[model samples]
Target: MIGVLVTFTQNEKFDRSTLAGIASELRGPFEGMAGLRFKSFMLDEDGVQARNFYVWDDEEKGRSFFTKELVDKVTGVYGVPPTIEYLDIVGFVDNSGT
Candidate 1:
Protein backbone atom coordinates (compact mmCIF):
# COMPACT_ATOMS: atom_id res chain seq x y z
CA MET A 1 0.00 0.00 0.00
CA ILE A 2 0.99 3.59 -0.51
CA GLY A 3 0.26 6.63 1.62
CA VAL A 4 0.21 10.11 0.16
CA LEU A 5 0.06 13.48 1.85
CA VAL A 6 -0.65 16.68 -0.03
CA THR A 7 -0.54 19.98 1.81
CA PHE A 8 -1.50 23.49 0.79
CA THR A 9 -0.34 26.64 2.56
CA GLN A 10 -2.13 29.93 2.22
CA ASN A 11 -0.95 33.46 2.77
CA GLU A 12 -3.93 34.12 5.05
CA LYS A 13 -6.09 31.90 7.20
CA PHE A 14 -8.84 29.98 5.42
CA ASP A 15 -12.43 29.88 6.53
CA ARG A 16 -14.50 26.79 7.30
CA SER A 17 -16.85 27.39 4.38
CA THR A 18 -13.91 27.59 2.02
CA LEU A 19 -12.51 24.40 3.42
CA ALA A 20 -15.89 22.74 3.04
CA GLY A 21 -16.10 23.79 -0.57
CA ILE A 22 -12.66 22.49 -1.31
CA ALA A 23 -13.38 19.17 0.31
CA SER A 24 -16.73 18.92 -1.43
CA GLU A 25 -15.23 19.61 -4.83
CA LEU A 26 -12.58 16.96 -4.28
CA ARG A 27 -15.00 14.29 -3.11
CA GLY A 28 -16.56 13.73 -6.51
CA PRO A 29 -13.26 13.03 -8.21
CA PHE A 30 -11.73 10.76 -5.61
CA GLU A 31 -14.49 8.85 -3.93
CA GLY A 32 -14.81 5.32 -5.36
CA MET A 33 -11.87 5.94 -7.65
CA ALA A 34 -10.15 2.79 -8.74
CA GLY A 35 -7.03 1.87 -6.79
CA LEU A 36 -7.84 4.45 -4.12
CA ARG A 37 -8.57 3.05 -0.72
CA PHE A 38 -9.29 6.19 1.30
CA LYS A 39 -8.85 9.92 1.55
CA SER A 40 -9.08 12.33 4.48
CA PHE A 41 -9.57 16.04 4.15
CA MET A 42 -7.91 18.04 6.88
CA LEU A 43 -7.11 21.51 8.09
CA ASP A 44 -4.23 22.30 10.38
CA GLU A 45 -4.99 23.45 13.92
CA ASP A 46 -3.91 26.97 13.03
CA GLY A 47 -6.25 26.98 9.96
CA VAL A 48 -3.63 28.38 7.61
CA GLN A 49 -2.98 25.12 5.89
CA ALA A 50 -5.02 22.30 4.39
CA ARG A 51 -4.08 18.74 3.66
CA ASN A 52 -5.38 15.55 2.07
CA PHE A 53 -4.21 12.15 3.24
CA TYR A 54 -4.63 9.29 0.84
CA VAL A 55 -4.21 5.55 0.94
CA TRP A 56 -3.78 3.87 -2.43
CA ASP A 57 -3.51 0.27 -3.59
CA ASP A 58 -0.08 1.00 -5.00
CA GLU A 59 2.47 3.68 -5.83
CA GLU A 60 1.38 3.71 -9.49
CA LYS A 61 -2.12 4.78 -8.60
CA GLY A 62 -0.84 7.46 -6.27
CA ARG A 63 1.51 8.82 -8.89
CA SER A 64 -1.15 8.77 -11.58
CA PHE A 65 -3.55 10.77 -9.46
CA PHE A 66 -1.14 13.43 -8.29
CA THR A 67 -0.30 14.84 -11.67
CA LYS A 68 0.33 18.22 -13.26
CA GLU A 69 -3.39 18.60 -13.89
CA LEU A 70 -4.04 17.97 -10.24
CA VAL A 71 -1.54 20.63 -9.26
CA ASP A 72 -3.27 23.08 -11.57
CA LYS A 73 -6.64 22.17 -10.16
CA VAL A 74 -5.44 22.59 -6.58
CA THR A 75 -3.79 25.90 -7.35
CA GLY A 76 -6.97 27.08 -9.02
CA VAL A 77 -9.10 26.11 -6.06
CA TYR A 78 -6.86 27.11 -3.15
CA GLY A 79 -4.61 29.62 -4.89
CA VAL A 80 -1.46 27.75 -3.93
CA PRO A 81 0.63 24.89 -5.12
CA PRO A 82 0.56 21.83 -2.88
CA THR A 83 3.55 20.08 -1.38
CA ILE A 84 3.04 16.37 -2.01
CA GLU A 85 4.73 13.53 -0.21
CA TYR A 86 4.38 9.81 -0.88
CA LEU A 87 5.30 7.04 1.52
CA ASP A 88 5.08 3.31 1.92
CA ILE A 89 2.36 2.28 4.33
CA VAL A 90 4.11 0.45 7.12
CA GLY A 91 1.14 -0.27 9.35
CA PHE A 92 -2.29 0.97 10.46
CA VAL A 93 -5.19 0.30 12.80
CA ASP A 94 -8.82 0.97 11.94
CA ASN A 95 -11.85 0.42 14.17
CA SER A 96 -14.28 2.96 12.78
CA GLY A 97 -16.70 0.33 11.60
CA THR A 98 -18.16 -2.80 13.16
Candidate 2:
Protein backbone atom coordinates (compact mmCIF):
# COMPACT_ATOMS: atom_id res chain seq x y z
CA MET A 1 0.00 0.00 0.00
CA ILE A 2 0.98 3.57 -0.48
CA GLY A 3 0.70 6.34 2.06
CA VAL A 4 0.77 10.08 1.61
CA LEU A 5 1.61 12.49 4.39
CA VAL A 6 1.09 16.14 3.66
CA THR A 7 1.93 18.95 6.04
CA PHE A 8 1.38 22.64 5.56
CA THR A 9 0.87 25.88 7.37
CA GLN A 10 -2.29 27.83 6.88
CA ASN A 11 -2.32 31.52 6.25
CA GLU A 12 -2.84 33.73 9.26
CA LYS A 13 -6.22 34.74 7.93
CA PHE A 14 -7.36 31.20 7.31
CA ASP A 15 -10.64 30.47 9.00
CA ARG A 16 -12.27 27.27 10.13
CA SER A 17 -15.35 27.92 8.05
CA THR A 18 -13.31 28.06 4.88
CA LEU A 19 -11.43 24.89 5.80
CA ALA A 20 -14.71 23.11 6.46
CA GLY A 21 -16.02 24.14 3.06
CA ILE A 22 -12.95 22.81 1.34
CA ALA A 23 -13.10 19.54 3.21
CA SER A 24 -16.77 19.11 2.43
CA GLU A 25 -16.17 19.63 -1.26
CA LEU A 26 -13.37 17.07 -1.36
CA ARG A 27 -14.67 14.35 0.94
CA GLY A 28 -17.08 12.64 -1.41
CA PRO A 29 -15.11 12.57 -4.64
CA PHE A 30 -11.90 11.56 -2.91
CA GLU A 31 -13.50 8.78 -0.95
CA GLY A 32 -15.11 7.40 -4.09
CA MET A 33 -11.94 7.34 -6.14
CA ALA A 34 -10.58 3.93 -7.05
CA GLY A 35 -7.83 2.52 -4.79
CA LEU A 36 -8.35 5.20 -2.16
CA ARG A 37 -8.59 3.28 1.08
CA PHE A 38 -8.97 6.00 3.71
CA LYS A 39 -8.05 9.51 4.79
CA SER A 40 -7.54 11.33 8.04
CA PHE A 41 -6.91 15.02 8.52
CA MET A 42 -6.09 17.20 11.49
CA LEU A 43 -5.31 20.81 12.19
CA ASP A 44 -3.09 22.29 14.87
CA GLU A 45 -4.47 25.67 15.69
CA ASP A 46 -1.66 26.72 17.99
CA GLY A 47 0.94 25.65 15.48
CA VAL A 48 -1.03 27.08 12.55
CA GLN A 49 -0.49 23.86 10.62
CA ALA A 50 -2.44 20.99 9.13
CA ARG A 51 -1.69 17.38 8.28
CA ASN A 52 -3.37 14.85 6.05
CA PHE A 53 -2.85 11.11 6.16
CA TYR A 54 -4.04 9.15 3.18
CA VAL A 55 -3.84 5.47 2.31
CA TRP A 56 -4.07 4.20 -1.23
CA ASP A 57 -3.88 0.82 -2.86
CA ASP A 58 -0.95 1.82 -5.05
CA GLU A 59 1.23 4.67 -6.19
CA GLU A 60 -0.73 5.23 -9.37
CA LYS A 61 -3.93 5.74 -7.45
CA GLY A 62 -2.31 8.29 -5.14
CA ARG A 63 -0.67 10.20 -7.97
CA SER A 64 -3.86 10.19 -9.98
CA PHE A 65 -5.48 12.41 -7.38
CA PHE A 66 -2.57 14.59 -6.40
CA THR A 67 -2.60 16.29 -9.77
CA LYS A 68 -1.31 19.76 -10.39
CA GLU A 69 -4.75 21.24 -10.66
CA LEU A 70 -5.79 19.94 -7.27
CA VAL A 71 -2.56 21.01 -5.68
CA ASP A 72 -2.84 24.49 -7.16
CA LYS A 73 -6.36 24.91 -5.91
CA VAL A 74 -5.52 23.74 -2.42
CA THR A 75 -2.41 25.89 -2.18
CA GLY A 76 -4.29 28.85 -3.51
CA VAL A 77 -6.82 28.49 -0.76
CA TYR A 78 -4.17 28.34 1.91
CA GLY A 79 -2.21 31.18 0.37
CA VAL A 80 0.92 29.24 1.23
CA PRO A 81 3.00 26.45 -0.20
CA PRO A 82 2.79 22.89 1.12
CA THR A 83 5.35 20.20 1.85
CA ILE A 84 4.22 16.70 0.95
CA GLU A 85 5.88 13.33 1.49
CA TYR A 86 5.02 9.91 0.11
CA LEU A 87 5.69 6.74 2.03
CA ASP A 88 5.42 2.96 1.75
CA ILE A 89 4.13 1.38 4.91
CA VAL A 90 4.63 -2.12 6.20
CA GLY A 91 1.49 -2.19 8.33
CA PHE A 92 -1.25 -0.09 9.92
CA VAL A 93 -3.32 -0.34 13.08
CA ASP A 94 -7.07 0.32 12.96
CA ASN A 95 -7.90 1.36 16.46
CA SER A 96 -11.07 3.17 15.59
CA GLY A 97 -13.04 0.01 14.84
CA THR A 98 -11.88 -1.89 17.87
Candidate 3:
Protein backbone atom coordinates (compact mmCIF):
# COMPACT_ATOMS: atom_id res chain seq x y z
CA MET A 1 0.00 0.00 0.00
CA ILE A 2 0.98 3.58 -0.44
CA GLY A 3 0.25 6.60 1.70
CA VAL A 4 0.10 10.15 0.44
CA LEU A 5 0.00 13.17 2.70
CA VAL A 6 -0.84 16.56 1.25
CA THR A 7 -0.50 19.40 3.71
CA PHE A 8 -1.46 23.06 3.54
CA THR A 9 -0.41 25.77 5.91
CA GLN A 10 -2.42 28.91 6.46
CA ASN A 11 -1.64 32.04 8.38
CA GLU A 12 -4.66 31.55 10.60
CA LYS A 13 -6.91 28.77 11.71
CA PHE A 14 -9.79 27.86 9.46
CA ASP A 15 -13.17 28.52 10.99
CA ARG A 16 -15.68 25.71 11.24
CA SER A 17 -17.72 26.90 8.29
CA THR A 18 -14.69 27.18 6.10
CA LEU A 19 -13.58 23.71 7.05
CA ALA A 20 -17.08 22.39 6.37
CA GLY A 21 -17.11 24.03 2.98
CA ILE A 22 -13.78 22.53 2.12
CA ALA A 23 -14.98 19.08 3.06
CA SER A 24 -18.22 19.50 1.17
CA GLU A 25 -16.50 20.56 -1.98
CA LEU A 26 -13.92 17.81 -1.83
CA ARG A 27 -15.92 14.83 -0.63
CA GLY A 28 -17.43 14.07 -4.01
CA PRO A 29 -14.15 14.16 -5.87
CA PHE A 30 -12.49 11.88 -3.36
CA GLU A 31 -15.24 9.37 -2.82
CA GLY A 32 -14.71 6.16 -4.77
CA MET A 33 -11.51 7.47 -6.29
CA ALA A 34 -9.61 4.88 -8.29
CA GLY A 35 -7.42 2.58 -6.21
CA LEU A 36 -8.11 4.58 -3.08
CA ARG A 37 -8.72 2.62 0.08
CA PHE A 38 -9.69 5.59 2.19
CA LYS A 39 -9.03 9.28 2.84
CA SER A 40 -8.83 11.20 6.09
CA PHE A 41 -8.93 14.94 6.48
CA MET A 42 -6.75 16.18 9.32
CA LEU A 43 -6.11 19.38 11.17
CA ASP A 44 -3.17 20.28 13.34
CA GLU A 45 -3.75 20.98 17.01
CA ASP A 46 -2.43 24.46 16.57
CA GLY A 47 -4.96 24.91 13.77
CA VAL A 48 -2.49 26.50 11.39
CA GLN A 49 -2.27 23.51 9.10
CA ALA A 50 -4.50 20.95 7.48
CA ARG A 51 -3.74 17.70 5.71
CA ASN A 52 -5.37 15.06 3.62
CA PHE A 53 -4.13 11.55 4.14
CA TYR A 54 -4.88 9.08 1.38
CA VAL A 55 -4.25 5.39 1.38
CA TRP A 56 -4.00 3.75 -2.02
CA ASP A 57 -3.40 0.34 -3.38
CA ASP A 58 -0.14 1.40 -4.98
CA GLU A 59 2.03 4.34 -5.92
CA GLU A 60 0.51 4.68 -9.39
CA LYS A 61 -2.93 4.93 -7.86
CA GLY A 62 -1.79 7.64 -5.44
CA ARG A 63 -0.09 9.65 -8.21
CA SER A 64 -3.03 9.38 -10.55
CA PHE A 65 -5.15 11.81 -8.58
CA PHE A 66 -2.83 14.53 -7.27
CA THR A 67 -2.56 16.53 -10.47
CA LYS A 68 -1.54 20.08 -11.20
CA GLU A 69 -5.13 21.16 -11.18
CA LEU A 70 -5.57 19.72 -7.73
CA VAL A 71 -2.51 21.55 -6.54
CA ASP A 72 -3.84 24.76 -7.99
CA LYS A 73 -7.17 24.18 -6.34
CA VAL A 74 -5.62 23.50 -2.95
CA THR A 75 -3.53 26.62 -3.25
CA GLY A 76 -6.54 28.65 -4.24
CA VAL A 77 -8.46 27.40 -1.24
CA TYR A 78 -5.76 27.59 1.43
CA GLY A 79 -3.83 30.50 -0.05
CA VAL A 80 -0.64 28.46 0.10
CA PRO A 81 1.01 25.84 -1.99
CA PRO A 82 0.65 22.38 -0.52
CA THR A 83 3.52 20.14 0.51
CA ILE A 84 3.02 16.62 -0.73
CA GLU A 85 4.74 13.50 0.56
CA TYR A 86 4.42 9.91 -0.49
CA LEU A 87 5.50 6.92 1.56
CA ASP A 88 5.14 3.21 1.68
CA ILE A 89 2.54 1.90 4.15
CA VAL A 90 4.61 -0.58 6.07
CA GLY A 91 1.76 -1.49 8.37
CA PHE A 92 -1.71 -0.42 9.42
CA VAL A 93 -4.14 -0.98 12.26
CA ASP A 94 -7.86 -0.48 11.77
CA ASN A 95 -10.37 -0.95 14.55
CA SER A 96 -13.18 1.23 13.34
CA GLY A 97 -15.73 -1.57 13.40
CA THR A 98 -14.79 -2.80 16.84
Candidate of highest lDDT: 1
Model 1 pairs whose backbones collide: none
True-structure Cα RMSD, model 2: 2.2
1 or 3, greater by TM-score:
1
- What does the lDDT come to for candidate 3? 0.85
Rank all candidate structures by their TM-score, best first, as comma-separated numbers. 1, 3, 2
Q: For model 3, how does the per-residue alpha-carbon lDDT over 44-75 read when each residue is reduced to its tens digit?
A: 88888888889999788798778999899889
* Model 1 quality (TM-score): 0.91
- Tens-place lDDT digits, model 2, residues 1-98: 88998777855635666666767777887767688888876677665776778999888888677888878876886667677789997988868787
Clash number for each model: 0, 0, 0
Specify the poorest-scoring 10-residue window by lDDT in model 3: 14-23
Question: How far out, in Å, is residue 14 in model 3?
Answer: 2.1
Best of the two (1, 3) by lDDT = 1
User: In terms of TM-score, how similar is model 3 to the real structure?
Assistant: 0.87
